[model samples]
Target: MDTSFVKTPQIQQLLDKAAGLQESGGNPRLKAIVRDLTEALMALIVRHDISESEFWLAMKFLGEGAGEIGLIVPGSGLEHFLDLYMDAKDAEAGRSGGTPRTIEGPLYVADAPLVEGNADLSSDPDPDAQVLHMTGTVTGPEGEPVGDAIVHVWHANSKGWYSHFDPTGEQTPFNNRRRIKLAPDGRYAFHSRMPSGYSVPPGGATDQLMQALGRHGSRPAHVHFFIEAPGYRTLTTQINFGDDPFAADDFAFGTREGLLPVPSRQGDSAYIAFDFQLQRAATAAEQGFSARSRAEAG
Candidate 1:
């Protein structure tokens, strides 16, 4: 049987050959995943008329940009897709009343400072930056306060550069990052400088791809959070500055309506109040796992 690809009939034969070349009996789930992926790639190639050179070029890009691939996922909407899928599952399971989830960007660093209730996150603050006082309460779906919950938050600097990613010449690993344990009443507060909008690094793979698609890789001013408690599902989310020009036009598509923080000010510092309500964990594996805690466990 000639499996040459002169016609559409050879597509199935090629797919079968590619999927069957791998030995099995080790991780059946991985085998099924590869098989499905192979079929999907085959279909995509045929439907789009992708040439040999084009496929090879894409592979080359992947090889060169492997390190930045994780960063590209949110920019290309996969991170948001996962969040939406999880939300759908939560709704189906009747797990409602939590603050809406958002994408965790690629800049998260493990093991930030664990502050007591009501601490300042502006470690080494800029002289000209405006201060921000953020206060919030974490609660359960049934309206009970969740004490001892870890409320981790990080954001960009006055120049829109993150600490670790931008290579700040500092001894500490975390800048503008803090982890505050909720008070006995489930309340937590932090004071930090208001962050500015940031864009993807220029001349990188993500920037190149964005330029090819006629898009800019700029994100609005926002603060990231990963909140977790003993009996609730982990919440990875962000609070977008509602008045920012790019608030509605984030390149990562992460600016949901519920995640936008209302703007207010008082006496030389800004204030934003947003409460977080988390759902009860449906399973044992879903409870008490935070980003820092997971990193520590590993």
Candidate 2:
């Protein structure tokens, strides 16, 4: 009948000792966190009459929550955090005027076919699908051309399934994927068929979670790009097809006004062209390395 004994001063002293350990030069922010957690736990014990089993269950849930955070960091919004951090750093260094950087999604594949000029990247035999020719010039912030810049491109097939991830065996080798290098004047071009919209895998873990949350799991029609140069910031972004139904409502929240390309229909071809202006490398150490190399090392 007398549960007040659970809130004894000895327990408070024990919590203070734990707080002191967390404060010992590890991280000041972590020290404050320890204090807050201890106070919150004490309040919960006083308010709800928690059992030992319930306490263990709460701990298990906390561990699972941390794992969920890791998943988000890799496959979701946490990737955007790094982009915003780099943007702030660039702002502090007075680096201004370049194409905005965006996050690379989880489906990028390396070492695609290196094609010259323009080539058909589509695998479908459908004659009704419009052929898309995308041409762009890669330039530095000073308006000078960046020759020999490597542009890696990949997109879903006409049916909205990527090569490696689609289980239906519908994607051929390098279907809707190619890599191209910029010419002397920083120009690059490639052709691919228009891709359809796709939804997240049905009945999979990602879809199961979305269903419980009453959320849709559709992604707009878009192409992925990983552009790199010897002395510029690596750009990992996606270009949305203009007429996609979900273009303005991408579930990933990755679509930006400048990133969307205008799709033109002329006879049997669709054309999209946009100039990419990249920021200059700020330090001598970064002048010789590529973005893929840096990503590999990390």
Could you say which candidate leads in lDDT? 1
In model 1, where do residues sit more than 4 Å from their true spots? 1-17, 20-24, 168-171, 288-298
lDDT of 1 by residue, 26-94 (tens): 666766677678777766777778899999999998898876776688888898898889889878977
Task: State the C-alpha lDDT per candidate.
Answer: 0.81, 0.72
User: How would you encode candidate 2's per-residue C-alpha lDDT over 65-166 as one tens digit per residue?
Assistant: 452432233334566677788779878988777787766665666667787777667765646667878888899988989997888888886677877766
Considering summed lDDT, which 10 consecutive residues are worst modelled in model 2? 289-298
* Structure candidate 2, residue pairs in collision: none
TM-score of each: 0.90, 0.72
Reference-based lDDT, residue 167, model 2? 80
Model 2 regions lying over 4 Å from their true place: 1-76, 123-128, 283-298
- Candidate 2, position 67, lDDT: 29
